[model samples]
Target: MASIAEVKAQIEQAKQSSQQAMRAVQMLNNQLDQAIQQITAASQGTQHPKVQQSLVALQQAKQKASEVQASIAGGVRSATEYAAQL
Candidate 1:
């Protein structure tokens, strides 16, 4: 088993990693929003099924990204709280 200081260090590292992931997820979501907007604008007059499929995929990706962001935020919070306890 690891010592108390080692455990604390591990928790702190994990918390930092989680925070980094959260930032990345935020950036990804922002980019996806821009892509969706562009896709919508480009497909304004087109009845192509491909466009529809693309939009659907983008929406799905946005949803998944949101979920990931939430998960990462929760992890970061949990890790920080745990490390504080130590």
Candidate 2:
């Protein structure tokens, strides 16, 4: 049987994990925004095939990162809820 202190520790850990996941999501969003700005500037000023390809890659990366972040957030929420119940 786990002690109350152990349960409280677990809850705190869950909260920290959730906060870290949120921070990671924010970082990914920032990167996506920067990538979009780069793409827009490149399109407006000069046309380079390599730059266009990079932009596409960056967009795809952003999409994937978003999905991962969502999944992580969901897991964190679920874990936190479960820990609270304990």
User: Which candidate tops lDDT?
Assistant: 1
Weakest ten-residue segment in model 2 by summed lDDT: 77-86
lDDT of 2 by residue, 5-83 (tens): 7987977787797778778877988988897897778688778887788888888888888888788778877877777
List the candidate 1 regions with Cα displacement exceeding 4 Å.
none
- Quality of model 2 by C-alpha lDDT: 0.81
Assess every candidate by TM-score. 0.83, 0.74
> Where is model 1 poorest over a 10-residue stretch in terms of lDDT?
77-86
Angstrom error at residue 45, model 1: 1.8
Q: Tens digits of per-residue lDDT for model 1 on 1-86?
A: 99889998888888788888888988988998999899889889888999899989988998998999888888878877887787
User: In model 2, what are the clashing residue pairs, if there are any?
Assistant: none
